[model samples]
Target: MNVNPVELHEVSFAYNGTEVLRQVTLTVRPGEFLAVIGPNGGGKTTLLKIILGLLRPSEGTVTVLGTDPVSARAQIGYVPQRSAHERDFPISVWDTVLMGRLGRRAFRLSYHSDDEDAAREALRAVEMLDYQDRQIGRLSEGQRQRVFVARALAGRPRLLLMDEPTASVDVVMQAGIYQLLQKIKQDLTIVLVTHDIGVIASYVDKIACLGGEMFYHDSKEIGQKDLEKMYDCPVELIAHGVPHRVVREHRHD
Candidate 1:
């Protein structure tokens, strides 16, 4: 039997009575690398916020790991959108990564060998172990993002949620982050929200696209007509072994 790591039932949220999510019903399975793709202002960030327990749904229920997300918040490792954070903060990479140790520190009054080991291992996983001693302020955008990921990994979370993981990184570094994420997926389940259709056809196990409502496709490769119904717009295919769709913006006549 397959167990869902996250489940949302008739979930609705609003700001001042303006509905942002219209009863979104979704399920995310364990060990699945799922991508939630949608245009801006389509409640992509809002939905992630709801899942992270930052905001409670105005209506309906959200269960994460068989419990409310707010109750199980510590079990999740989150990497927010790059723009969501202020990279100018004066903090050393080692101290930043060690913050993930706070959760484990409660058991002991001091930092134990295991906590340090985990932090070092997390940095190693992202290949940023050498930069651990440097200040995050001096690092490049890509390197800084890698450190942020290391902070989350030190928690040894069961589920990792990232909103726009490659947002601020350069094109070349964006590909690098994608490869790094694939390496981490072996131990933890990853759920990322992205609009870049270029790599979804290759990296993701499944694509759950959200627009007006939601469309969950078990197969990344499907019939053209089905995709048309999902996007409700004309989609052009750029055939090059990996199927690519050139989604054009629609104009109001």
Candidate 2:
């Protein structure tokens, strides 16, 4: 039997007496691209933390690559919603990506030839090799995001998790990033959290709608009823070519 990349059975989480996720179960197969959509404070990032073993669930079991998430973390790559560094920080694009290889090295004094090769290959994959020596602060928002992706790729992870990768980029850059992800998904499993339901449908293979509860669908074409149930309000989806729109109906009563 083919082993799943991630599995969560009846998982739940809480923070300081407030519950975030309840009875959430999810499974991700190999090479599948899954998108998680929801409103603010809806436990989307909390669920990712559980899967990454950054936070333990209050209840239920979590597994990654047939092992506990904490034990399998070395094989996973993560791209957070925002960069923690300031724009003025003195760091080069290549050096930032080289950080990903630190986890594999026995000593932090120097990077080996293999580490440099991996970092260069990752930069090339994201079309950022030409700017390797440039300061990260000098790049555009889209270019910076691509460099971050290259940082993750330098690890050669089997599974990748991204949270709001395109939140700060423009529409054209968002499309470019998603297209890059589509090519990368051929070899690894990816789970992304975002609020852009319309744009994500065209790229991901499956959708997971989360609120306090969770709804999973095998296809991106979510029904009206499912949308209403997930959002707790009447919802409408309109499609125009590759772009789509999701609108919530307001009650006049």
Candidate 3:
């Protein structure tokens, strides 16, 4: 039988005796695109860390790929928030993407032909094969974001986790990145932590609102009541640069 790509059962995390996440339980199925959105300091990144095994929960159980996180590391790929320093790093795109192979297998002194093929395929997936030899620093922010995604894809992970992949790009570029994800979601299970609630509805299959607790009904259709509870205010949901109803008509209170 197939197992879920991610499972968290009553997971709670605390730092210095302060609670960050409480009883957060979630399940991500194979080939599903899920978006985690909430206010800052809501433990979105912390939840990803728990799934990645970077941080153990203070309470409850976590499973990734039906096994312990560390053991399942090879099947997971991560794309961190873009950094300005990364843009100026003096490295070729090819080398950057090849680094993804480091996580999939035992450490090797040099990349083999298989590694090269994987990197090439990943670059092609993101349409960045032509820029393989170019300096990463010379590419546009959107292009650089694609390279980062390619780096993650090179690992051939069944589960991909991204943190604000479009944070550095403009709205148009953000749409482009989401479009790319839409194309690739058929083959991978994606759990993305983002603040872009507007554009996410058009791309992701489901949404989870995290704010020390998870408010998800296992569907992408979230109501204004849930949004207000998550954001602590009335929210006007937007999609495609226009007002969109995720669940019900907006109430003029």
Query: Per-residue CA lDDT of candidate 1, range 1-253, in tens?
Result: 2457789898888878888778888888888888887666667778889898999998889988778898767778888887534666778998888888786577666788888999999999999999988988889999988988998899898888888887867888887887898898885778888765565556767777676456667746544554565455555432222455344444323
CA lDDT for candidate 1 = 0.78
Q: Using TM-score as the measure, which candidate wins?
A: 3
Clashing pairs in 3: none
Candidate 1 structure, TM-score to reference? 0.86
lDDT of 1 at 84: 33
Look at candidate 2 and tell me the lDDT of residue 72. Answer: 86
Error of 2 at 109 (Å): 2.0
Residues forming the 10-long window of minimal summed lDDT in candidate 3: 240-249
TM-score of each: 0.86, 0.91, 0.93
Task: Please list the C-alpha lDDT of all candidates, in the order they appear.
Answer: 0.78, 0.85, 0.87
Off by over 4 Å in 2: 232-253
- True lDDT of residue 217, candidate 2: 77
Arrange candidates, best TM-score first. Answer: 3, 2, 1
